[model samples]
Target: MKRFFRLPALGLAFTLLFSTAAQALTPDQCRDLLQQYYIDDIPQTVLDQETIQQMLEALGDPYTQYFTPEEYKLFTSSMEDTVLVGVGGTFSLTEGGLLTERVFEGSAADKGGLQVGDIVTHADGKPLSGLTLDEAGQLLRGEEGSSITLTYLREGKKHTAKLTRTAFLVPTVYSQLVDGHIGYLDCDTYGVDTLTHFVDDMTAFSGLATSWIVDLRDNPGGDYYASMGTVGCFAGEDALSYLLDNQGKYSAYRTAVESRTMYPALVLTNENSASAAELFASSIRDTGTGILLGERTYGKGVAQSVLDQTTLPDYFPDGDAIKITSYRFYSPGGATNDTVGVIPHLLLDDDLADEAALLLSTPAPAGDTTGYLRVDLEWRWYIDLDQALSPEYQEAFVALLEALPDQVKVWQGTGGADGWTQTSAAALAEAHGLTDYTRRGFTDSADSPYRASIDLLATYGILQGTGDGTFQPETPLTRAQLCALLAQALNCKMPSGESQFTDVDMNAWYGPAVNALASMGLVNGVGGGRFDPDAPVSHEQFVTIMGRLAQRLSMVMDLAWQNRPDTAGDSFVGWSDWAAEEAWLLAEGQTGLLGNSINLLWDLPQDIDPDAVTTREEAAALTCTLLQWVGILPELS
Candidate 1:
């Protein structure tokens, strides 16, 4: 959600001269608000209120309250601004079948080979059969430059198209009278002309609704004046809130006496509701004017002010002035709500009845973790990376490098390390101190194609043959087995951390590796907070893991490499982008250590077999490959 101050330049307090006769704040209110109430310290009696306001603005607070002259103009201009960008296609998914109504010329759709009248069966790979057009549109829409895949049906065969979303205009406010007697205001954000549109809506629903519901879910705050104007519509001339400063001083802000509502009202909110929306809901409830429904409001008690550009040299001489949290706001009842948010009168649990019952019941204390995970567990993994890579691998890698320079830097140094000369498998094994070793179970297989790779793995303590002299080469590798092998190949230590997945027992053989991999951000559980450790590892999942391993090694080795640039971050780059690069490496005939390493894992297929369940032999070969790329083995001849 985009949060910004919405008031115009004319409303700026700083624009009015410090000694101007026409002022909104009284002498005491001005002195207290500027000198005593602000987060910073100020002189008792030295300069004018305008200069005092500028000094108060210098203090960094959550609410950047004071806007400089130039900044005030920009703040007001945003309210009247229009023009946005979005994905470049028109869609309609009715019972008649999902139809592409139109595809904009020269847009992402046209560039990606999408044509008008193409029947889209699925959006982002999910079937569009049961979804409303709006839902499907929402699925297709995303931030500019972010892509979504559409599994579209053209003629009789199925084809896929990926498109990057661009900007497009979308309304911020939606209001109507629902069920004949209920005025329903579905506000997406508080923007310029929002209050005007809202007032028009209210007048239209004046003789209609007996009750009202102002829905503020997913609202990223906008103009404070717009929100305050909204509050005035319900709270009347009452003291809406008090702003408190560091010096124990308070300033009262009253609502417009003429705009109060007399009807019973309910404000709908959710976890996404924040900033000005929180203030609006809390003020309504505090003034005994309305009841709050849904979850607790997002706790964003601090406000920001837009400072003028002229004051930039005074405090921060580099850029234009900004909003800071000068004062902490209090409810009309005198309760400070900063980190702690306004509690709802009714708790919504996806239904009104369930919410009513839950709200009435004694609330359980909140836990450290959000019980629900946000991943869609049911997504199909049939879309091949090679399909996207085969045609646009170069462009994809360039994009990947741009988006994730640090990860790419690690990958770029794969065979570029010093003292990392190409060596034979036997020589690489000897270099790693693997001397006293003998084949136990596979002694009879002298001509086995993978004997060298298998022996090298065993020598390095990366794998052990099956018991009773039987190396079960044909057995499928389970999730747990892969975790163990990868951990050993990476030379990672057994983790002391507890398991986060419900199915991963702490005492299990793979627990340490699983936990360690997760802690290192190399793996994530299959949703529902459960790690299906025993499930057979699929070809796609293994490659995904291998890609992560390579990137992790890249980052580690890059750090130790002399004069390497600092590019580390909190999270690893996404696997899809890196995996696409890996696909390119396989598609194009790249050789030496990197090529030999990839070949050891899987024979390069035209379209990588993402669905095929990999065998134990394959896992072992891949582990050997991992060792080779990290400079633990020589390039394959």
Candidate 2:
């Protein structure tokens, strides 16, 4: 059967139109096609360029391209995963040379006795050291029936081999059982045979593996349909991604295949993981089907459609084609991986990511499994009762376990330096019905009145604790932090462009949050074009921000309180003059805009400080309350 390819990062939305005649495409034709289908409007000046290449260059879109007949053939052939004449292996450039990452079975590399770890120092008598991976690959690839002499280093020893270039299909899926229990599947690309190969591997490992690890590191992505099918193997039949076209229309691309099985999965990613790989990772993360480990992915959220005779039959009588960026895609959660790639649930170094994943996936030992709680806190954590602790600590652990809510019992710790956390069990349990079996706990704020609120936010990832596992509940909330927290709570898209505030650095951790909220008119600068990001946010200030946000979101505010005769204007005293009206609207009654009773200064007793800074705990509580009201988070019992 012939396969249609959808290379999300480079090429997508394939419309194959076979033709026999060859003809040169005019600049006008190219400009017309782009104007009709490009993701953004083309400038008239750019369209009037004298040549096709010049017009494309003026447009400045790297993904959009005009392909000659020969180039188009090669591109289609590659997308189809056809047999190619070359040494059938993948290589990564290293200081020494090009390191062989994989050697295809029964191909030129394997037949020549080239191993996975072999570094090719020279190809055809030319030194390959210090060359780019693509440059070295160019040197190694050749026509069929051609031979090339290769000099390589294996295990610190030099070796040479004369290999004849032969036709072979590049393997896309590789699977093996790691530690005899983890199903480790490495997907190279989302190609035509990817779904089939992925299913075959899953079928092969059906009963043997208890957990699964999908490695998408360095995967450049391909075949959008195949990706949807493969991701469906884990995330089930849900809307995996949404596509938005230039005409302001939205279309959902749901998982095309049924879920094979549901197991805790750890997906590994890096900067090179793009397009379909990002789609797979984002769907898994957003749907709670898996946890992502390693670095953020390559942000390539736009897709291209190959235009040919089918799309513009009159313009293209020849076999040539033009690829145009036609749509922008988003994750099921409505987050785009365009410029800001998908952030991992757990950030890990590439060297230790696999080991950490294996450790996290392994279940607790069976013997005396009492008092142990298996929790899926970003990744899996097994909390066991350590007998070595003092009686008080042990008793505290038990009490904490018993106090855990039913959801905690069914759901899945503090992470440690090695990717697992070892903190106070009592503090973790009291905070969210979770306890760490390791020594020490969140020493600070253990007895805070807002411990529950703080931990609840942490549990849901709406807030993060200090790196030392301490919830600094008393820490004053800053304007930047508030924006960041609100952004996460609302699942806002990361904003593009520079910071609006002159004082705000766009590269800072909180910059995206501030920019996103500011762009939506939910936030404002202090004065003089400065955001004053580090300034403490007072209670009234916070309330006023929330009130503005509610208005923007069109939330229904309780009118009964606003209209009540007893609710005098003086009741909102102590609030800043500029914030008095908003304060009343956000916290005047039980069914305020937040949908919960927020004890602002107006509700507090006289003489109580009204100008006090909002603490981190207060910020978390407010954010959580808003989330619950908006149905983004469930109300805690």
Candidate 3:
């Protein structure tokens, strides 16, 4: 959307002509122009390429380089389009050699006797053996009119011919759906009309998905407008980035107010993602519209511009040009990614590098660090173990355990015991980098206070809404619902046959969960072989069910603390306190042999109303905490 124009007369090629000037302009004039016009132009101190290049060399900036006319043209042409000068032949490799499939009639390849079905073995003196078809083809390409020597086999006879490089286009922007619903747009670079094509593809994708993965991996960079345009797609009228001139003056580039997409976005980057690509990803992340996932990017934070020929100083001519370091770009947060590139929010290992779709599908947790964990029955072990160790030792031990070789599958349990039991599953998950486990859908429930926990539980497939897109978190949780949630959260297997409760329908929605728990002896039938499926679960009843469930999970807590002499005057030590104390306050109370098990479960607020009827929201919060303690759920932050 931005346009640049040069002044007339002054726009004439400096090598051929000049206007009202006795002699050619000096480097000082060129320096002055850059100081006035460059986005982040340098000060008057550095006068010529020798001085500037030396300064840049000291700073270790490889991109600020001198460009001859030929190199400058090639660079500018690439920025305009992916069309490259080559011996225009579409090739396919065969065992014999590089076979020519199709050659444009007037192209250098066809005009040079490079016929279809010809097997090419070498270019110049370089043999084609072990070279990919694409690599061989690249060797045959150079500046237009440049000559290349190719050895080819035709009709079983080998012959060598020299060919000139000609221009042909290569595909750049590619868009498609990945993993059924995720829209994947891989942009190799931003060239002429690339933004137009990208906009078209994005419009097409809007109807296909509510989430997207914009892949900018290995993209070196392109025109300034194109970079701004790419960032504009996801940002509103906010500053996409800023530029700092040599004088310390800052200029901002902002996105158009009307050209923005609200769809949740995730940008894929890598160590090769640089310049414009880094800008796009950084803008997306800084604007609060997206998250970046992958390795750190290539730190090419400076912007470049071609010095107009007429504006060129006497040291250069029309056939020569230089691409100068115009300005140093800054991220939206005003941080420069020059030498140190932008780091991703989620650092992925190689196995997860291509799993962008899956990551995007998982709903991110609220900004709160605790929302990522889940509260479940297995948390007792972490609690007991932490109680036995000093806090500093516990922290160090966990770090050491996390650093152990994954093949060993070792995790420290209560009393520093080593075992292969299920209690060590969480540590194993961490060791193997298997963190993500849930895909929640409650992100749209904006007005709910329990949105974080609800979304987390839903992500893990432990709970879904009561239909109609509502979780009804405030409603009292019923016995059947609670049983179903517990079964799902614990991954309980369905048991055979039926329970003794007459009121429980075998074909009903909650029957399998009830039966599973009943078979495990974790739940009981009311009087007369009846289970009240619709009865609201009281705090005491909920605690009993959880305690029994914990026992089933091999984590048992003793009630002997209730009679502790140190806590004699306490009015009521309900199930909530017992669960909490068993998990965290183990050694403090009058309990004996407190190192039975360790559970790093949810930390309940001090004022938790233990005797109150358990609400669905409270259950979700508790479930999330317990899941975290047992290591079934990962820390969101």
Candidate topping TM-score? 2
The deviation in Å at residue 400 for candidate 2 is 24
Report the backbone clash tally of model 1: 28
Once superposed on the true structure, which residue ranges of model 1 sit more than 4 Å away at CA? 1-82, 85-169, 310-319, 350-637
lDDT of 3 by residue, 1-637 (tens): 0001111111233322212222233445445555654554354345446443344344333554444555555555554534546787666666756777555546788789887678888889788877876577568657898999999999999899898787755434556655455666767677776687567777777766656778777677777667677777767555557776666556777766344356756677777788888778777766656666666677677887666465554556644454567677766655555544665544443124444334334332333322121112111112223221334333333332222221222223222122213324344346444443212355355666767677666644567778766777788999899988887666565665765688988788898888877876667878898889999887556655654543222111222333335553243354455344332322232223655433222233334455667888867876765544322343332
lDDT of 2 by residue, 1-637 (tens): 0011113313422332222234478777787788889988899889779878778789987788777676677565654544556887777777988888777677898899998779999998999987776678789878988999999999999999999989877557767677677888888788788899778888888877778989998788776788888888887776467787888666788886777766767898887888889888887776777777776677788888888767776777777788889987766755566654666655445555665565556566455434444554544555444431335344443433332322333222223322333334345555543444332224575677656556555644556566787768889989998888878655567876878999888899899999988876778898899999999998878877876654433213323333535443356677677666666655553354557655433234233345878888777666655544432333222
> Using alpha carbons, what is the TM-score of model 1?
0.37
Looking at model 1, residue 389 earns an lDDT score of 29
**Every model's TM-score:** 0.37, 0.60, 0.43
Better of 1 and 2 by TM-score: 2
The C-alpha lDDT values of all candidates are 0.53, 0.68, 0.57
Between 1 and 2, whose lDDT is larger? 2
Q: Candidates 1 and 3: which is better by TM-score?
A: 3
Candidate 1 lowest-lDDT run of ten: 374-383
